[model samples]
Every structure is written in C-alpha cells, then in structure tokens.
Target: MGRSKSPVRVITAVVAMAALVLAGCTKPGPSLRPTATTNPPGVFGPGADGLGDTYYPKAGNGGYDVANYDLDLKYDPPTDTLTGTATITATATADLSRFNLDFTGLKTEKVTVNDVDAAAEQSGAELVVTPATGIATGAQFVVKVTYGGVPKAFDEPGLGEIGFLHTDDGAVAIGEPEVASSWFPVNDHPRDKATYTVKIAAPEGLAALSNGAMKDKRSAGGWTTWTWSETKPMAPYLATVVIGKYRVKESTHDGKPMVIAVDTSLSAQVDAQMAQTPEVIDFLESKFGPYPFDALGGIVIDDRRVRFALENQSRPIYSSAFFEAGEDGTWVIVHELAHQWYGDSVAVNEWKEIWLNEGFASYAEWLWFEDKGEQTAQQTFDNSYAPADAEMWRVPPGDPGKSDLFHESVYTRGAMTLHALRVTVGDDAFFKILKAWAAEKAHSNATTPEFIALAERISGKQLDQLFDDWLYGEKRPPRPRR
Candidate 1:
C-alpha cells in the first residue's frame, strides 16, 4: 500500500556476495501428523486453538484444514445489517471433540454440524463449536453457521481499518492478515487456503461483486443475489465482497474472462484507467510468465474511506483516488495486478515472510518501468538507497514485526532486496527464478527460505550473505552493482 513518490536520483555504493545457508532463514514448524497413539481408544479430544504461526500464532485454528467455503450473505445498506450462512467443508487433521473458528462482532443465530444442532460459544474472537459426536482423524465434516447482525468495521491495531468497511452507498469487505473473521467465520490465515463459493444478496439496485467469475444473478422480493465461485485455492486474506451501485463491464482479455466495475460516482473518470488493465496484465504475463488466475479484471470502489488498494484474488480492489490521479495511477494498477501472480497465486506461509508478497509486487512495478524504457530498476533502487533516514533500514523486510506488517521498509527495501539478488545472480538466471518460483508454487503457500532455495537452485549460486545483508541486516547494505 506504500508508494514511492520522489523524483529519480542515482547513487552508488559497494555490495558483496555472501555464503548461502539453506537452514538459516525461518522455517515452518514441525507438521502435526495424526496418529492413533495420540488418541485414547478413539476418545477424541479438542482441536488446538491456534496454528502456531510465529507472527500471528492464533490467527488460524488447529486440528482441521478447510477445503471449501460456501458463503451465503444478505445485506441491507439502509439498515446496515448483515445476515450470513457459512457452510464450511473441512478435513480433520486429528480426532476432534470440538474445534475453533476465527470470528468477531456478529450475532450467531444457530450452529449445526452435519445437519445436527451443535453448541456454539463466543469467546473474544474465537468461535468454539462442539458437535454431538466426535470426529475421527482424517474424517471429513461439514459445519454450517447461521449468523446475522450489523457487521463491525473497526481498525485493526497495526494493520489499519480492514474487514467489512462501509461506504457512502454500500459496504466493501476487505480482509487481509486477520480481518476476514469480522465478516464470516474462517480459518483466517494465509496458510489454510481453500476454494470459495460466495453468494451475496443486496438491494435490487446495487451490484454485488466478489472474487473469481460471476456465475449468475437472480432477483426476488426486491432483493438481488449474485453468485461467484473461485475454483483455485486462495488464502483467506485475498477474499473480498463489494456491494454497491456501479458500472459493470464484462469482456475478454487474451482469451480470458475480464470483469471491471467502477462506482457510478466515478465511472466516467475511472473507465479510461480501467481500460488499460488488460495491457498491464499482458505486460506482467510477458515477464512473470502466464497469468496465474482463470480470470483477469479489477473493481474500482469510489470510497474515500479506504485509502489503499488490495490484491484480492482475481479482482484487485482499487480506490477511486487512483483514477483521479489519471496516468500516475497506472503503476498502482500494475502493482496490484502483479500481485495476482505473486501474492494471490503463490502466498506466504507465514506473515513474517510478507516480503514474498509485497517485495515481488513492488519489484514487479520496477520491472514495469524498466520494461517501458523509462529509468531502469537500478535507478529506482539507487534513488531509494540514497536516503539517509535510519528508519528506512531499521526493520528488515523479513522481520517487520506485527505492528509494522505493512511498513514502507517491507515494500521498498523488500523490492531493493530482490534487485540486489538480481545483481548477484545475472539477468537470465534471475528472471528464470521469478518464472520458475511462480510456476512451481502456484496455488500454494511459500516462505522466504523457500524462495532463497529456489533462487539458489535457478542461479546455481549461494546467496545467503546477500539475503542476510539486505533482508536481515539492521543497517542498509551496499547496493548491488550490476
């Protein structure tokens, strides 16, 4: 969400190549393998309350992994009330007597497991559900939660205002990090990826938009329902729902379905900007390989309340201010679209490695300018590196901490880290690393160490020192010379 806004300047500094250590960076915790010995003669126990992620430990639940989500939601903007039914299908990783769900601020009407009534209790952000019978390890189960009330849209302590946000005319659901729980019950972490079938209902005049291709829309009793299904596996943060009055356009880009929506208030100014979306996607495809998603499009919500754009699966959410900036906003479009390949397709397993998302997307912007024959990526890095502000390099991109999740260091310095890596590994191998990383990890979760391994594999060189200096060092290291 951070943007570099200074004129181009060039600087030079000394950089060095370092040793590669495969086991150096943070690694995922030991996987919990369910075994019969762990349970006492089929007497099931409760699932773990958290997934053990180092950064946000309690963001996702344990014991079960979500496979699919069927979300049916109805909202009336006049009353600002949201009624939702979330049918979650998951496979238990261990024998479970009860499980937990990440949710907040919604009234629960009823809870059912496999069509039978279940006991549901709300403790802070956790929804504890206990079914009548215990579930066996590896057994598949279904949970349906019926909830209704006015959804909360409060600011996340460190991440800013997220979740279901209200606009002048309607509401937009933007979940990143851990905010999805505010709207619907979810595993609520990037590690637990799942397919989603979102069915949304709103007033007849408003258009409902979500991730993936729109399947259909039906109207009954002054309310219209819109159905969208995302077949590919997606992290919870990338899920989104926008309900408002807008100008909708359905078209094809490079033989793929494309859907673009602009708020009626700013459609005139945003249409031209939105039209260039295809060209941006095409350019990214040429560099990053084929587009990762089945669809290619975006939604422009003209709301001043939300300040940043998000790479929400197939359709990235944009703020109307981008259009108001005219041509200056093109890079922002390119940035978010680039994330469809980096952040959405190949997600980070832990929040600490968010550089895997923001860094790649930020570097993609530099690649765009370089591809356009403008100032080379080195020039951009040089200008950014010239700044003497200690805060810029204080927190390494790999360890931005909880509150600094979206720090400017993560975006700019993160991109700089990649450029330095490109310098360490020549262009041919560096570009190969990019494409190969995306293709291999498509629709899966990854971490920084994995990316380092991939880079070493593709370049046939050790890069531990380079990554350590640029990503983990407290001070800014010398810029790599190409």
Candidate 2:
C-alpha cells in the first residue's frame, strides 16, 4: 500500500510509504500449514476463533487451511444492497465439529457444510458454524454461506474507514490487514492464502473489475455477470472487487492479460498515467525476476475516501488523488507494482513483519527514480536520513505496534535498512539476494527473521547486528560503510 492521502511528489520529498462467493469444490492448491493441534480420533472440538497474530489476535481463524473461495454475488447500486453466496473449500487441520469464519455486517440466510445444512450464528465479526458432522484431520470440506445486506466499512483507529465502501455509481471492497470479512467469509489473515473464483452481477452498463484473468462475461436481463479467476494462491486482503462506470482497457503484455480501468469521470491524463503500467512492470521484473501473476493491470478510483493505493495481487487499485493536477504519479505506481513481488506474491507471515512489504516497495520507488536519472537511491536514502524525525527513530520499523503500522518510519526507515544492506553487501550480492528471496518465497508468507537469514546466506555476511540496529533499534544507527 502507498502512503495515505499524499501526492507522490510530496511523499517522495517527505518519506516513502507504506471477493466473490460461490460454493463449489475448488481445485486443490497449496494450503497454509495448520497452527493448531488435532483432537483424538473420535473426539470433536471447535476450531479456534483467531490465528494468534500478535497485533490482531482475533483476525484469522485456526484449525483449518483454506484452499479456495468461490463467491457468486449480486449488487444493486440504487438500493446499495449486496447479496451473495460464498463457497469455501478447505482442509480440516484438526478434528472439528465446528469452525469460525471471520465475517461482518450481512445477514447470513443459510450455511451448509459438505452439502449438509449447518447451524450458523453471527458473533461480532465472526460467523460461527457448527457442522452437522465431525471432520477429521486432513479431510477436505466445502462450506457454502448465503448472505445479503448493505455492506459496511470498518473504521479502524489508525487505518481509517476500510472494507466495503458504498460509492455513488457502485461499490469498492478494499483494505489492508482485514477487509475480506466485511465482504465475504474468510480466514482473513495473510497466513492462510487461497485461490479465488469471483462471479459478480452488476448493472449492465457498469464494469466490474477484480484480480486475475477474466473468465467470462455475459449479460442477461438488466445485469451483467463478470467472472474472474485467480489460480495463484493469494492472501485474503489482496482480493478486491471494484464496480462502477469505467473506461475499461484490456490488452496483453508479455503474454499476460492486462486490464486497466479508470473511472469514467477522470481526466484523459489519468488514462495516460495508467498507460505506464507495462513499463513499470518491465522495469520491476528486470530487478525482481519475472512478474509473479498471470494478469497485470490497475484500477483508478475517483473516490476521495480511498486515499491510498493498494497492491491487490494481479490488479492494484489506486486513488485518483495520486494524479491530481496531471502530476506524474509513476513513483506511486512503482511503489505498488513492486509489491507484486514483495507484498502480494511474498506476503508477511504476521502483520508485525509489514516492513517486508512496505520496505521493499519503498526501496523500489528509489530504484525507479535512480533509473530515471532523477535521484540515485543512495542520495534518496541520505535525504531521508538527514532530517530523521525523533518519532521515526523512536518507533522501530521492524515492530511498530498495530496503531503505527502505516507510520512513516515503517516505509522510510524500512527502505533505509535495505539501502544500508546494499552498501554493506555491494550491488552484485544485494541484487542477487533480492532475486533469490523473490524466487524462494514466491506464493508464500514470510517473516523478518527469515529475510535476515536469506540476506546473510546469499551475501555470506553476518547481518544480525546490522538488521537489529536498523530494524529494531530505537536510536538512529551510524550510516553504512563498506
């Protein structure tokens, strides 16, 4: 995600920043390793409510690993209602008679487990489901939930209003840390990544956009159904659906599907900026190995409420504020597209390790500017380090508390950490460590320690003290020296 409500140029001078339902048998894919233990053979127990994330303990559920989510949804713009059926395919990691899905707002009309009617009740933001029968460890089961209502956005303390936002012409489902629950039943954390098949039914004239390749689109009656599929395992937060009137442009880039959508109300300059999508991807690919997804594109929304741009897997969504006054917002584009390699493809194991996502992307912005001959990365790092704020040095980027997750220190200092490492290890090993990290941790979740280990291994340097000082130290450390 990019910085909140700031122009790319202003933010650069300051600091670097920061779903459908369906019920069906999803193809078997990679599953998150279960964090909970199995019960006795015949014994049954309820799945844990949360996945034990340090920042948000109640964020994701435990005891099952989700493989896919098939969402068939219909939205009425005039009435602002969203009705949908979500089919989740998952494997029981333990003996479970009941499990929990993180969900909010909508009224659940019905729920079925493995085709059998199951009892479900909404508790706070969770949908507690009691299966008719017990599921053994390693047993795959399908959960179908039929629900509908006016979706509501989550007003987090520091994160602001997120989740589902009801717009004028349509709606947008986007957020970080936890947005999936506001729209669909989900595991809700990066630890449990899954494939997605979303079928959205919207008014015929409006375009519905989502992640990955478009599978099918057909209009019947007054509504058009847009079907999209993402075969690559993706974190729940990375899944998004934007519905509204859009000037949609579809093409192919490097043998991959490219779909860019801009709000119809936006200026032609926005379209021109969107045209730079492929160029940014090619530049990022050269440094980060191949692009990780099958599709590439972006969605530029015209809502002032959405102040930040998010790296939503294959297709990212940007706020129009980035391109105000026809400014070149390619730096923000680079920040988000770079996340296709760091944050989206290689997600953080826990929210605390967000620097793994924000840091690398911030560094990518510096790299892009350096490539353009505007400013070298070393120079950018020096600028950020020169007048470092006390708060920035006080709050460690490695473990910024939940409230300070998107704080300036996380992006600015996080990128500084990488530059410091680059200075320590030299360019050859630095770039090699980056490519190797992307290749090794592709389509998976990782942690800061794991990254430090990878950097040490690839560069053949002891980097613990370096990482500790830059990532965790409360005081600013001395500048890097070879």
Which has the greatest TM-score? Answer: 2
Error of 1 at 322 (Å): 2.1
* C-alpha-based local distance difference test score of model 2: 0.84
lDDT of 1 by residue, 257-280 (tens): 899999998846577777889989
Q: Distance (Å) between predicted and true CA of 295, model 2?
A: 0.4
Clashing pairs counted in every model: 1, 8
lDDT (10s digit) by residue, model 2, range 73-189: 999999999999999999998889899999998899999999999999899999999998888888999999999999988776545678889898999998887889999999988
Clashing pairs in 2: 20-71, 21-70, 21-71, 21-72, 22-70, 22-71, 22-87, 23-87
Which pairs of residues collide in candidate 1? 20-464
